[model samples]
Each structure stands twice: as C-alpha cells, then as structure tokens.
Target: MQENKKTIYSWALYDWANSAYATTVIAGFFPLFFKSYYSADVAATTSTAHLGFASSISSLVIVLIAPLLGSIADVYSLKKRYLFLFSYLGILMSAMLSLVGAGEWQAALFIYILGNIGFMGSNIFYDGLLQSVSTKKSVDFVSGLGFSLGYLGGGVLFSINVWMFQDFEFFGFEDQATAIKASFISVALWWALFSIPLLLFVKEDKSTHISTTTKLKDGYLRLKKTFSKIRQLRHLSLFLVAYWLYIDGVDTIIRMAVDYGMALGFDSSNLILALLLVQFVGFPATLLFTKISEIMGTKGAIYLAIAIYLFIIMWAATMMEVWEFYMLAIMIALVQGGIQSLSRSYYSRMIPEGYSAEFFGFYNFIGKFAAIFGPLLIALVALVSQNSRVSIASISILFIIGAILLYFVDEKKGEKELKDALT
Candidate 1:
C-alpha cells in the first residue's frame, strides 16, 4: 500500500508537470499573445479561425490514432516509450512558441497544432498509466490528487507568467508580446523539468505475447476488432456516449471561459485572478468530492457535478459584474476536477484489465470527438451573435442533456459486468 501510494504520487506529478502547458500556453498567455502579436498582422479573425481549424484537425487526427497507439502500447508493453515520445513532442513545440514572430501566422498555427497534438496524445498514454499504477480502490483519490496537483502547479506558473507579462520592463523585455513569448519558453522548461520524476520512477509492464513488428500490425487489427466488440458492451457504450456529450460542454467551458470574460470587458488581472481562484479552490474540492464518491459512489458524484455545472451556466448567463465572475469561478472550481477525475475513475472501474489501453482508447475517442462540438458551437455563435456572452450561455443545453442521460445509467450493473469480464 505504501508502495502504491508512492507510485500514485509519481504518476500525479506528471499532471503537475504538464498542466503548465494547458494553463499558460492554452488558457492564459498564448491566445492573447497570438491575437496581439502573431495574428495581429493577419486579416481580422483569420488567426482565431485558423487556430480553431488547426485544433479541430489535430483533434480528429488524434482520435483516429489514439486507439491504435494505445493498442500497440498494450500489446508490446511500450506505454512508457509512447508517453515519452508524445511528451517530448509537446515540449519541443512549446519551446518553439518562443520563436513565433509578427507576420508569422502560418508558422504560429503549425506550432500550436503540433503542441496541441503532443499535449492531447500524451494524455492518452498517461491515462493508461493509471491502470498499471493502482487498483480500483485507489483510482478516484489518486486521479483527484493528480488534478489537484495539476491545478496547483499550473496556477503557480501561470501566476508567475502573469506577473511577468504585467511587468515586462523588469526583465528587459520591450513589451507584453516579448514577455508573453518568453512565458512559452518558461512553460517548455518547466514541463521538461518536472516530468523527470515520472520518467525516472514509473515502470512499464512486460508483454511476452508479441514482437514489436507484430505488435504494430496487431495494434491496428485489434482496433478494428475492438470497435466491433464495443457493441457487445451495451451499458458501457451508453456511458461513453453520455460522457462524450457532457465532457464536451466541460472542455468547451475550460477552453473558452477566459475569452468570454475578456470579451465582457474583464481586465487581464481579473481574468488571471479568477483562474487562479479556480485552481486553488479546485485543490481541496477535488479531494473532498473523491471522498464523497467513496460514500455515494461514482454515478451519484457525477450527477451532483453535472447539477453544479447546470447552476454555473445559469449563473454565468445572468452575471453582470466582476464579482459575479469570481463567484462563478468558485463554483466551477468546486466541481470541475471532481467531475473529470470521477468520470475517469468510474470508466476505469468498468473496463477489463488486459484491454485497458484499448478500452481507454475508445474513451479517448469519445473525449477527443466530444471536444470538437463545444468550441465549434462557441465559434459559430460568436460569429453569428457577435456576443460572446450570449454564445457561452448556449452551453447549458449540453449539461442539461448530459445530466438527464446520466440518470438513466446503472452504476451497479456496470460494476458487475466489469468484474464478470475480469473473472
């Protein structure tokens, strides 16, 4: 048990390491910097549209490849190698963000897509690492710990970047653009520095069943076989479908909420503060919700999380003040990590051991595909309404529909099926 705890902590540290990319590169500085510096020289909204399109394209590619890569890793016991490969890909691209210059919109977009692909692809393998590290009893708490540490780590680095962006002159940078670009360098360095623990400590299982060449071939073939077998797992399939829709809403909110706040005239400081609040608040709340899941079970906790999300959407729609935005941030922090952690743990509980990577590949398939709709919806609505606030409000429908479907799922039955399959 002590060894398991050590392994879990090591696993969670990777979350701590990489989340800086999500917070700084994805959420905090990059978008604003892109628009102000790299994209400003381009035609209006072309940069924004290009970013969306690039992300969408990369997401689609990852969706197609994730299952195959996961299957290959499982068959050949190459999970750690895959994790390193993708993590380095992200690191290389993140480091390249510092090189983006004015009038280099195409290059910027290409780098962003590469970085995003690396970020998303690494997560597929990182998530698969969970099965090898811990059992069902510890999954929720450990997953929550990862998210909590992620929030803490990402927030700390982002706060530093915010300070730098606000005070660029202190560092001999001429302006915000230079500081922001430098922040990308920091993100790359920080990610590389912190990732050492996991790479050093975590061990991959050995698979004697297949050679490397055959593993590659069999991985693709197994993906086809798994797709057909998915039909046999009715309840699990339904849950994946439901998770796909609802998690889309969640992902959309995380990606676009800051942009929405900025559009509503909130200053960068306030936006940063709000995000910081969410990070700190998420830390404890995530652990508490994990405990609640132990008492109430995964489905119940998820239902509660979905309910909270509904309230946040309604609250945001009616918000007219900065304080109100802060309030909403608190609400999101309380449930966001919990929902995501519990969902992953719940799904893990339902999958058989030998096929964990394959099953989670389908899980990633849903996740990647789900990520598409909300952003596209936001972009489309912003295009039509020219009102980012109103566009964001439209996300409520996803939560409502997701919550209703979640109610129909039988958690006990899913657990039974998973155990039977293992036996």
Candidate 2:
C-alpha cells in the first residue's frame, strides 16, 4: 500500500514537472516570442502561417510515431526508460530556446520541433503508466489529481516568468524578448527539478518478461493485431474517432488561443494573465469533474465538458470586449483539464490492462491526428477570410459534431465488453 501511494505521488509529480514546459514554452511565451522576435523582419500573416505550419508538421511526425512507440513500450517493458529519455530530450530542447534571437525563424522551428517531439513522445509513455499505477475505481480521481498538480506547478512557474518579463531591465535584458528567452530557461530548470521525485520513486512494471528479440517481433505483430481487433471493438473504435475530432478542436484552441489574443490586439500582459488564470483554474476544476463523474459517470462528464467547449468557441467568435475574453478564460478553466483527464480515464476503463499501452498508443495516435485537422482548418479559414476570429469560431463545429456522435455510444455496453475481456 505504501508502494502504491509512492507510485501515485510520483506519477502526479511528473505531471507537475512537465506542465511548466507545456504552459510556458508551448502555450504562453514561445508563440509570442516567435512572432515578435523571429518574425520582426516578416509580414504578420506570413509569420502566423509559418508558426502554424511548423506546429502542423511536428504534430504530423508525432502522429506517425506515437502508436508504434506505444506498442513497442508495451511489449518491451521499457515505458519508464522511454519516458525519462523523452523527458530529457524535451527539457534539453526547451532550454536551448534561450539561444533564439531576432531573425531566427529557421532555428526556432528546429528547436520547437525537437522540444515538441520530446513533449508529445514523453506523454505517450507517461500515459501508458496509468494502468500499472491505479485500479479502476481510483483511476479517475488520480488522473484528475495529476492534471490538477500539473496546472498548479505550471501556473506557479508561469507567474514567476510573467513577473520577470514585466521587469526585464533588472535582469539586464535589453527588452521583453531577452527576458522572455530567460523564461524558457526557467521552464527547463523547473521541469528538471520537479521531475526528480517521480524518477526516484516510481518503479516500472516488470510483469511483461518476454525476451528482447521476441519482444521486438511480438510488438510488431501486436501492432498489426490491434488494428484488426480495433475493428471488432466497434464502440471503442467509434468513441476513439469521436474523441479524435473534438479533442483536436480542444488542443487547437489551447495551442492557438494566446496567439489569437495577440492578433486580436490584446495586450501581452492581458494574454499572459489570462493564460495564468487557465492554469490556476484548471487545478481545482479538474478535481471537481472527477467527483462529478462519480455521480454522472464518465460519458456524462465528457458530454458536459463538450457543452462547455461549444459555448467557449461561440463566445470567442462573437467576443467584442476584452472582458469577454476573461469570461471565455473562466469557461475554459472550468472544462479544459477535466475533459482531458476524464477522457484518459474513460478510455482506460474500456481497455484490458495488459494491452493498456497499445490501446493508449491508438489513443495518442488519434489525439495527434486530431490535432492536425483543427489547426489546419483554422489556418485555412484564416487564409481565406483574412480573419482570425472567423477561424477561431469555425472550431465550434468539431465539438458539436463530436457530441452528436458521443450520444450514440452506450457506456453500459462498453463496460460489459471491458469486463468480459478481463475475465
């Protein structure tokens, strides 16, 4: 029992550790820094296009690799090692961002890709740890706890960086760009420092004891078999497809919202504060959703989240005042982490534990693929309409469509199938 508690805490700490990178580098400062510093010599639209393309390309690579790596980890029992490897990769790449300066678009793109590879790749293995760490009854709460801690940690570091950016001269930085670059250094330090507890305490599952050569062969075969089995599990397959669509929209929103704010004439300070609000808001809101799930069940909680997202997208589309953005931020705070945490738990509950990693690979695969459509769609709409607001508003259709499909999924039936697989 003590070991279990230690494992749970370690898993949660990893979430806290990596979220600094997600919040500061991915969501907060990097996009602004990329546009302002790297694209100072380029047109605004061109810069936006470049950033969008860079993200799309990196996501494309992750989509291709995640499932296979997931399958391999499941077969080989190397999930922990892989997690550490990718974590270091991401941390090092993020730290290197301190080197980016004016007229460094190509260099920025290069490091961003490496950093994202580390981010996305590490998550595949991190998620694979879920089944090994907790039982079915506790999974949702623990998952929510991890996400909540992540938000808290990321928010704290981001708040510090916000202060640093506000007072750049004290650091002897010439401008906000240099100070913002320093924020990347903080992200690296915070992530590395916080990850230590998890690395020390969490033990990898050793149940899968296949020989190395056999493991490699079996992993490939298993990948092929999963494709066929996925077809047989029609409800699970459909849910994944539906999740892929809506989650893409959610991810796109989180990734692009700050950039959209910048484009919409929101002051940098306001944008940073709003993002910080999301971080803080996500911490408790995620736990609330987990409790709500106990009464309403996972599917119901997801439906609630989808409803909230629909409202947010529409609100964003029509928002005329800066205060409206704050309202939208509150709405996101209410749903974002909860939705993601529930989604992971829901899917885990449906899969057999032995194959959790492989199924999660498919989960990661669908998630990465889902990321492609919303951003591409946003870019396409922005290019055609020359309006970021319209592009932003266009994302609402994903949630609406996803919700409609989710209504057809019978959770009772899914539960029965999962039980049968275990027995």
Candidate 3:
C-alpha cells in the first residue's frame, strides 16, 4: 500500500506542534518561571520540590488510567475523539499558565500538573495511530521522521523563546515575567495551530467488530479481553518487560545528564547549550538511524543504540574536561530519538489488529511507571555514595538488563502471533 502524503504530513505536524511544550515549558522556562514568580517568598529548594511533586502526580494519574482509556478508545473507534479532547485540554491548560500570579506556587503546581497530564495522556492515542498512518515496511522511517521533525520544531521555538526572554523590551514587553507569560501563550498557539492538520487530514481505522452496546459496558469487557490477550501473548509480555528496563535507563540519562554536568562544575550556559545541541543534531541523526535500521535490521540497530549508551554513561562517569561534556551531549543526540522512535514502531508491528490503542496503553504505563524508578535509583545512589558520578554510572545497569532481554524478543514470531490473534 502506498502512503498518503497528506496524512503523513498531518501526522508529522502534530509532533512539530506539541513539541513546543516539551521544549519550552517542560525543559526550559517553566522551572525558572516557577522559582522566580511563585517561590519568591520561599526557598529555592521548596519550589523545586513542588515541581517534582507536581510532575509525579501527573505521571501517576496517567499510569493508572492510560490503559483503560486506550482500551475504551479502540473498542469504540474513539482515537481521534480522545486525541482532540486531551490535546485541547492540554492547550487550554498550557495557556492558563499565563494567568498564574506571583506568590502562587500552589496554584502554579496545580495548573502545571493538569497541563502535563493533558500533554502526556494524549500521546497514548497518538502512538496508537501508528497502525492507521503507515505500513510495516515504512514504520521505522515514518516514526523517525516524526521524532526528527519534533527535534527541529522544538529547537526553533525554544531558541526564539530564549531570545525573546533575553530582550523583553525589544518585544514590547515591560518585564521578564510578562514576556515569559506571553511565550506560554505562544506555545499554546503553536500547538493548537499546527494540530489542525492532523485533525483535518488523518483518520483512524475501526475495522474490527465493535460493541453495539453502551460504551461503558463495552469498554470494561474490551479491557478484560485485552488483559487476556496479554496473558496469551508471551512475546508482548517479553517486549514490554524489555522496554520498561531499557527506556528507564534512556530517560534517566536524558533527565540527569544536564544536572550531572552542573554537579561537575559546568556552567548553566554550557548545560543549556547541550540541550539545544541534542534537539538539532537529533534531526539528521534520527534519519540516519532509520537507514541503519533498514540495512542492519531493527533489532540490530537498537542493539547498536544500547551499546552506545553503555559507553556514554561510563564516559560521563569518568569525564573531567568541558570539551568531553560536549562530546557526551553529541553522543546523546545521535541515539536518543532513534531508540525511542524505534521502540514505538517495533511495538506497533507486534500488537494485534484493532488493539493498538489498548495495548499501547500498557506500553505507556510501563514507560511512565518506569520513569519514576529511574530517578529514584539515581537519588538513592547519590545519597549513599555522595558522588553524582556514581549515581549516573549506576544507570547503565538498566540498559544492560534491557539489552539482554531485548535479545529474546522474536519479532517474526510476534508478528505471526498478532496475525493469528486477529484471525
């Protein structure tokens, strides 16, 4: 089957749109804005703690319900509906950040938590749409294109925001706070405006026998059936376990690398520069990985990524020079998008027909829950050793475990199982 260019563009544009939140709010401005505006009266530690708590709340909410939502959406042909609801909710909540007043740390946390939920929950259905939008042969390339474009789109807006904040007066804003607030609105607009393409062009396929009864009763039974499918499908269980371990290591590195750099006496400027470098370099690097997957096979390419991460973590643990830090950043840029995009596409290929949304819910659940553990491991290791390097190096164990397990996942067998399940 030939790919639909319009649908592909629309799907890719959604990544370009929502990535502003990932870049600007999640990674860049929100922390500083929260500290400066909301916690001016309290200690910096208190504000930072609040941010972490809010983030945890968001993840917890999604982990508990993502599978249920995904299952229900699949049974009722509601992928686009759920996507619209969550995306708009996220957009509204993101824009509402502009309304938070100074000295309102509690309110800021509330809004941030809701906004994050809206953002993360929507991805369940978005990832599930992989089956609807592309073919098995093209999956890796399409998935890589989305991530590659995401890196480029997010980097551009983030850079613009940085420049705008640095020169508030030139942008006709009187103060930094006001300028930051306006940028929040910009993210909302950017996400909303670009999302129109997906909403208008792409559509979900609901060819399986759907429940004609009430959605509630249907959803419950559908979810139960999904649970049974997992029990019967050994390959899926194996893949999920493998993904949970490896992605934890991958995500932990992304979250901790900059902070670890800070711990090692690098300036904030150098750290931010590294973040930008990852986003930009990821554009081309993701495409390169797509080709690599085509030539070496998906599993082979993924194994390559795991091996590189093993080296990167060990290198970071022992590094001493500023130049070496840049090298570590470049290494991350090379493999970060590849690992995630490939993981998603690989999972899509293995899921039973018409169960993409429900199954992906479990996928997202493992991912979100595992995220909690990775950070905690680093924290525990740091407390015990009093050395950030020890904490960073300890994460490599997760990749090693994941890679070992990944070696056992037979994709050919998994595909056959999905086909039999559907028949």
Candidate 4:
C-alpha cells in the first residue's frame, strides 16, 4: 500500500503527543515527587517498594488485557476508537495527579497505576494502526519519523517542566512542590493538544457492527487462533522471543538508569540534564539510524544497537565519575530510538495482513511481561551480592541471549511462510 502523507504524519504525531507523559511524568518527575512529596512520611525504602508495587500492578493489568482487547478490536475494526478511549483515560488520570495533596501516597499510587494502564494499553491499538499509514518500503522511515518526533516533542515539554520546577517563582508558582503539581497539568494539556491531529486526520478500517455477545465470542475464538498461529509461524515466534529479551534490557536500563546514577552518588539535577541530552540527541540519531538500516538491513541495524547496549552495560558497571554517566547517557541516546523504531518496523513486515493489532498485542504482551523479570533480577542480585554495579552488569545477559536468537530469525523466510500460510 502506498503511504498517505497526511495519514502517516497524523499517525506519527500521536507519538509526539503522548510521549510528554513518558518523558516528563514517567521518567522525570513522578518518581521523585512520589518519593519526597506524596510518600514523605514513609521510609525511603518503603516508598520505593510502594512505587515498584504500583508499577507491577499496571504492567500486570496491561499484560492480562492486551491480547484479548487487541483480538476484539480486530474483530470489530475498532482500533482507532480503542486508542482514543485509552488515551483519554491516561490524559484524565494525568490531569488528576495534580490534585493529590501531600502525604497522599496511596492515592498517588492508585492514580499512577491507572494512568500507566491507560498509557500502555492504548499503545496496543496505536501500533496496530501502522499498516493503515505506511507500506513495507516506507515503514522504516515512517516508524523512525514517529520516534524522532516523539523524542523532540517529549523533550520540549519536559524542558519547560524542568524549568518550571527549578524556578517555581519565575513560573508564578508558590513553591517547587506546587510547580511539580502544575507540571502534571502541563503534560495532560500537551498530550491532549498534540493528539488532535490523529483524531482529526488519521483513519482506521471501518468498524464492523455486531452484537456485543457475538463480538465477545468471536474475539475469544480469534484469541485462541492467534496462539495457534504464533506456534505455526516459527520465525515470528523467534523474533518475539528475541524482542522480549533485548527489549527487557532496554526497558530496564531506561527505568533504572536514574536510580543507578543516584546509587553511584550523582546529584539528581545532573541526571536530569543527562536525560535532556538524550532527548535532543535522540531526535537526530533516530533518523540517522533509519538511514543506517537502509544500508545495513534491519536485522543488522538491530544487531549494531544491541552491541552498543552491551558496551553501555559494561561501561556503566565500571564507571566512576558523573561525567562518565553522562557519556553513557549519550551512548544510550544514540541507539535507543533506532533499535525501538526498527524493531517495530521489522515486526510490521512479517505479520499477516488484517491482524496487525492482534499480533502487536502479542508483541506488547511479551514486552510487558518481560518487564517484570529484569527488575526482579536486579533486586535479587542486589540482595545477594550487595552490589549495584553487579546488578547493572547482569542485564548484559539479556542482550547476549537476544542477539543469539535474533541471528537465527530470517525475516524473508518469515514473510514467505506467512504468505504461504495465508494462501
């Protein structure tokens, strides 16, 4: 299918929209605010455990409902509607965060859980709509475009939020805590405003009208068939396994990087600056990575990214200075978006037509489920050895194993097999 510029741009802009939540709320302020503001009365470790528990609950919810919802959306051709539904839920929850007062840790965690569910759940349908916008030949560029714009958009708002928090009185806020609360509202507005393009311009396949009871029955049957289909599609299965492993390492590093920096005794302000560096650098680097994929092939590009990540892990474990941590952050910025965007595009090429949402659900399922493992591994290693560095080094195993499995995945063969199966 030929790409529609309007549809493609609009579809990509949704990434530009929601990433404000990812950068500012998820990665930047929420953990700090939850720890110092909401959970201020509790012990530091207690707050940490509570935050971790909330994260697990959100991930668990998404893992449980992802494929089932994806299958149902496919049956009803309701990807767009589902996407907006979850996005709004997230948006509403984000706005609500501003209202939780001091010492309201439980309420904060509860709303954060719901916000996370909305953020991650909506992505299932958003990813499903990829085929509606771009063809195989154009998918790489289009995917890269979305991620690049995401970096830029998320960075822009996060920078302003950081400024607002740093110089609260300049922003006309009474104090830093009040400024942080106000930042949540900023993210909600930014997310809502940027999402308008996709709502207005992008389109999905027309929804199939059916009785609710039949829809549920057909959706359940389709979900079962999808499980069988994965078993039959050997290379697709292999890729998912590989994806689950490496992406776990990727996500673990993303979620844990700041914590690691703080563990190493770096100031929080510097760590936040490093994150800003990543956002700005990632924008151009992601586009460059797409060009590299064009030259080296998608798998080769992914392999290169995995190699870089491996090197980063090794360096992170041994590094001493705060500047060294900044260097590692720059390194992560280089390949982070490349690996992610390429993986999505690569997977897009292999799945059967008309089931993108369902397959992407499985894709997300593996990713979300894998999330639970890496953090636990880190915790376990920290408990047994009492070494944060050793725990950080442990993640390299995921990349190594993922790369070995990815070596055996033949994308050409997978596409051929899918076509043959369909025929």
Candidate 5:
C-alpha cells in the first residue's frame, strides 16, 4: 500500500474533482436558487425544511448500505472501480440538474438527493484510499493538502459562477437562473474530467481473500466478523460516538448555513461572498492545522478545533448583522477543513490496514446517520418556531456532548490494539 508521490497527487485530484459540487451546488447557488425560485411560493422556513429533509433522506440511504458496501469492497477488491461508478452517477445527476426549469423544486430536490448519495458514497472509498496514498507519518500532511486543494479548486469554480450570476447579461445568458444552471453543468464536467487522473493512476492493493461464492455471501461473512469485533474495539467505538455527536454539528452547519442566512433575510450575493471567504481562508488554514497537529498531536489539535467551534456556535446564536456573519465565516474557515482532514488521518492511523475500506465504511456510515439528527432537529425547530435562528443555535449542544466524549479516547492504546489485531 506504500504508493509513489505520483499516486498520492493523483489521489488528491479527486478532491479537486468533487469539491465543485461542495462549493457551488451546496454552499453557493443551490440554497439561494431553491428559496428564490423553485420554492418561491413557500415561506423561507418551509424551503429550508425541504432542503433539510432532502439532506436527511440522502444520509439515510447511505447509512443503510455504506458498511455493507465497504465490506464487499474489501473482500472483492472493488474500491477504485466503485469509486468511479459512484462518481459518474453523481456527475450525471449534477448535469441533469441543468435541465430543471423554474418552479421545479420537487425535481430539483429529487435530483439533488440522488447526487448527494453519489457524492457521499464516492467519498467513503476515497477516504479508504488514504492508506494507499502516504506513509503514516505523512498522512496528516497529505490529508490536509487534499482538503486544501479542494477548497482552492471549488472556490475557483464558485467564484466564476458568482461572476456569471452577478453579470448574467455579460455572460450572454438570458437570466441569472440559467447562468446558475450552467454552473451545475460546469461542476459536473469538472468533476468528471479531473477524476480521470485517479481513475487512471491511483490503484488499490488486491484483496488477499478472493471470494469463491457470491459477493453477498462474502460480504455478509465479513460484515458479521466486523460486528462481532466492534465491541472489543473500545477506543474506535468511543471515537465514533464522539464523531457522531460533533460531526452532527459540523455537517449541520455546512449543509444549512446558506439556507440559514437566506431565512435571515440575507442577500444571496452576501451569502455567496461569505461562502467564498471560507473557501479562500480555509485553504491555508488547513495546512496550518497540519503543522498544529504535528506540534499539539492529533487529538489535542482536534480538541482545540472543537473548542473554537463551541465559541463559533455560541457566536452564531447572536449574529444579526451581515458583518457578523462574515466574521463567523472567518472563524469557521480556521477550523472546518482542519478538523475534517485530521479526523480522517487520525482514523486511518488507528485502523487495521487490511480492513480499511470496511472500517472507513463504518466510519462514513456513522457520519451519515449522525447527520440525520442535526438536520431533523433544525428543520423541526424552524417548522415549529418559524425561526431559522433557533434551529441553528441548537446545534451547539451536539458539539458540547462530542467534545466531552472525545476526552475518553486513548489514541495510543487504540493504535496498539488495531496493529495487534492485524498481526
């Protein structure tokens, strides 16, 4: 699994590929488009509710199957092949989004939900590839670099879309809505094109135990073993619980922020600008986090990031001014990518190399299920109180619980156990 530098860089290119959807569709245009166009007939809270529902549904779908898929992948040596399949599915769905005309919220919602599945499904395999991309000592740096590049790449595309949306006539588009749809196509194309390097270059180590029977049987056997082994893996189990809680808040903020701003009566342009600020700032800050992790240690650095998130959530509760939103974005920019990247590297370090795909599948499955609660909570709060602010504020409790549980994880002990298990 020790790969060359070329393999590592090619692997990182997938981040550049997929992040277009992260920035443009998720953060930049889709929220505003959903509110102002497709759901124009509904109240802002209702649109936000629908968006939350879509996110929750997508997460549920992945939650049901990610671990099983991961097990099958580990047994069948299907990681790279499946990554491409999911990536293409996502790309096609993203491209199809360009066809949704005005007042087609239902169509847009369905397509977006499917596309999200593809995006998240592909990422599970992508994260599993970390073991193949770099040595243990370099994993933190490599992981940080991937996220940093994603920010840069997604930001570049989003900035272009922002210009096109801002100057629709200059781009020779009939309207801003059309310009935004064009951006969806661009995101899809960029994803498909850049994914070529990884597809062509980066490769997985072949599975040692090839299944003689059907994949379902093979996967079931592996999955059964994984479940039985789970109880013995104390630190990994504790970390997943902590991750579910904290990442619930983290992902809630990512998925709901633009929508939150929209319901707050913020201008779409201002919100997009805030999104851009996070992208540009997050790029360098992610690298800085790699350095910080080296100095403070992974768990320490993660705790520091979580503490800052606590302050950020508290600040989010009272933010009313556009300037305050901008400030909040800056704070998030500092920790967002770092926490995510470091979490990936730290988890990779603790898992048995042979079971990486299956373990990471469980990891991502937990993440997806954890995502369901935050959005549901936010949507219900918004529905009941008819105020986006209240729902947004409630996310802080997840971070609080997560940080507390994270303290119980013994990293060295966990790594030793996983290594011993592999032996």
Candidate 6:
C-alpha cells in the first residue's frame, strides 16, 4: 500500500511538473512577450495571426499523431519512454526560448510551437498512465489530486515569475525582458526537476520487446482494429461525443478568457490577476469538487459543473465590470479542474485494460479536436454580430447539447457493450 501510494504521488507529480509551462508560457507571459518584444516591428493583428497559426499548427500535429502514438505505445509498452521523450523536447524548447533575439518573431514562434507540441503531446502518454497508477475506487480522488497539484504548482511558479517580471530590479535582472526570458528557463528547469520523480518511480505494464519495424507495423494494425471497434462501442462512443462538446465550451473559455477580458476593455494586469485567482482557487476547489463527486457520483458531479458553466457563460455576456470578470474566474476555477479530472477518470472506467494507451489516444484526439470548434464558433458569432458578448454566449449551446447527450451515457452499459462487441 505504501508502494502504491508512492507510485500514485510520483505519477501525479508530472502534472505539477508540466503545468508551469501551461501557466507561465501558454497562458501568461508568452503572448505578451511575443507582441511587445518579439514582433514589435509588426502590426498587432499580424502578430496575433502568427501566434494563432502557430497554435493551430501545433494542435493539428498532435491531433494527427496522438492516436497512432498511443497505439504504438500500448503495443510496445513504451508509454513512459514516449512521455520522457516529449517532456524532454518541451523542456529543451522552453529553455531555448531564452536564447532568441529581439525582433525575431519567426524564431520565437518556431520554438514556442515546438514547446507547445512537447507539452501537449506528452500529456497523451501521461494520461495513459492513469489506469496503471490507481484502481477504479480511487481513480476520481487520484485524478483530482493531479489537477489540484497542477493548480498549486503552476500558480506558485507563475506568481514568482510575475514578481520577477514586475520588479526585474529586485531580482537583479537587467530588465523585464531579461526577467521574462529567465522565467522560461525556470519553467524548463522546474519541468525537468519534477519529471525525475516519475521517471524514477512510476512503472507501466510490461510487454515483450520487439523489433522497431515490427512494432510500427503492429501499431498500425492495432489502430485499424480500434477504429472498427469504436463504431460498435455505442455508449463509449456516446460519452466521447458528449465529452467533445462540453469540453469544447470548457477549453474555449480557458483559452479565450483573457482575450474576452481585453475585448471588454479591462486592463491586462487585471486579467493576469484574475488568472492567478483561478490557479490558487482551483487548487483547493478541485479537491472539494472531488469530494462532491464521491457523494453525487461522477456523472452527477459533471452535470453540476456543466450547469455552473452554462450560468457563467450567460453571466459573462452581460457582465461589464472587472470585478464581475474576477467573479466569473472564481466560479470557473471551482468547476474547471473537477470536470477535467472526472471526465478523464470516468472514461478510464469504460476502456479495457492493456489497451489504455490506444483508447486514451482516441481520448486525447477527441480532447485536442474539442479546442477547434468552440473557437470557430466564437469567431463566427463575432463576425456575424460584431459583438464579443454574443460570441462568448454562443458557447452555451455546446454545453447544453453536451449535457443532453451525457444523460444517455451509462457507464455500465458502455462496459457491457464494449465487452460484447469485442467478443
């Protein structure tokens, strides 16, 4: 039991490890730095387009390859190795960001895109390890533990980084630019240092080694098999569809919130503060949300979260005050980690053992694709109505439809259906 406890803590530490990238780089400093420092010569809109394209391209690459990689990892028992490789790639790229020169937006974008790929791609295998680390009874708590840790970990480093950027002189930095670049190196080191515990302690299910060529061939074959099998997995397929829709709303809110705040004319520093609020609030809230899940059941907890998000979206449409934005951020923090962690654990219940990686490949694929539509939906709405509020509120439809579909996703039915279909 103690060994299992150690393994679980080790596994969860990766979330703590990589989340600094999410907070400091993806959500915090990079965009501001890109606009002011890297692409100072270009028009603001032009730099925005470049950053958007880089994000889309990196996401597209992950969407295309996640499933195949999962299949290969499953067949070859390579989840840990793959996780290490991608994490190393991310860590290296993050550190390299410090080396890019001013007015070199192209090089900065290239490195940032690679870093995004590394951070996002490694999650596929890290998620695959979920099943190996915890039993069914403990999965929800365990999953929530990871996200809670992520919030705390990401928030801690980001707070320090923010201080460094805001007061570069205190840190003996030459300037804020130097401070921001130094933060990148800090994220890389934090990611690398925390990742060591997982590599050293956590283990995956063992399988026999085979030639690389044969492994590749078998991987493709396995992926093909999963494709045919997935169609017949009625309830599981239904859950994935529901997850795709609702998570679309969730992810869109997460990715676009700061932009939405700017559109409402709030100060950038206030937006940053709101983000910090989410991180700190999310830490304890996720654990509380997990407890709520235990009482309400996973699906029930998810439904409650969806209901809250729907309300948040509606509130956002009419909210005109910076304080209102902060309130919305707090509300989102309460449910965000809970929903994500629960969805991951809930999906784990329906997939067969030994095939966790490939199935989670599809899981990650669906998740990555979820980010695309809500953004498009917002852009389309904004284009038609010329109102950011209307664009933001339009996301409610995704959650409404997702909740309706989720009503029919019976976990027992999914497992039974998968079993019969496989036989």
Per-candidate TM equals 0.93, 0.95, 0.90, 0.96, 0.97, 0.94
List the candidate 2 regions with Cα displacement exceeding 4 Å: 1-3, 206-215, 415-423
**Which of candidates 3 and 6 reaches a greater TM-score?**
6
Off by over 4 Å in 5: 206-213, 419-423
**Between the candidate structures 1 and 2, which one is better when assessed by TM-score?**
2
Clashing pairs in 4: none
Alpha-carbon error at 143 in model 3, in Å?
Answer: 1.0
Taking the tens digit of each residue's C-alpha lDDT, what string does model 3 give over 171-289? Answer: 99988888889889999999999889888888765534645456657777878876777767777778888899999888777655655665677765566667778788988999899
Poorly placed runs, candidate 1 (over 4 Å): 1-3, 41-48, 207-213, 415-423
lDDT (Cα, tens digit) per residue for candidate 1, span 139-195? 887888899899889988988888888889998899988888888989989998988
Q: What is the lDDT of candidate 5?
A: 0.88
lDDT of 6: 0.87
User: TM-score for model 2?
Assistant: 0.95
TM-score of 4: 0.96
> Please, what is the whole-model Cα lDDT of each candidate in the order they appear?
0.81, 0.84, 0.81, 0.87, 0.88, 0.87
Name the candidate, 5 or 6, with the larger TM-score value.
5
Error of 6 at 100 (Å): 3.3
Ranking by lDDT: 5, 6, 4, 2, 1, 3
Tell me how far the alpha carbon of residue 378 in candidate 2 is from the true structure, in angstroms, after superposition.
1.2
Tens digit of per-residue lDDT, candidate 2, span 1-423: 123888898888889999999999988898888877877787665666677777777788888877777788877777887888988999999989999778889999899988988988888888888887888888898889899999999999999899889988887888888888889988888888988887787776564766778766777787887776677765787788889988988999888888888778888788888899999988999999998988898989999999989888888987877888888998998999989999999888887766777788889889988877777887777777888888898888888888888888775677676555445
Model 4 lDDT per residue over 190-282, tens place:
989999998888866678878889877888898997687678988988999999999989977876677677667787778888888889999
Cα miss at 49, model 6 (Å)?
4.5
Candidate 6, residues 263-378: lDDT per residue as tens digits? 67787678878888899999999999899988999999999999999999999999989999999999999999999999999999887778888999999888878765666666
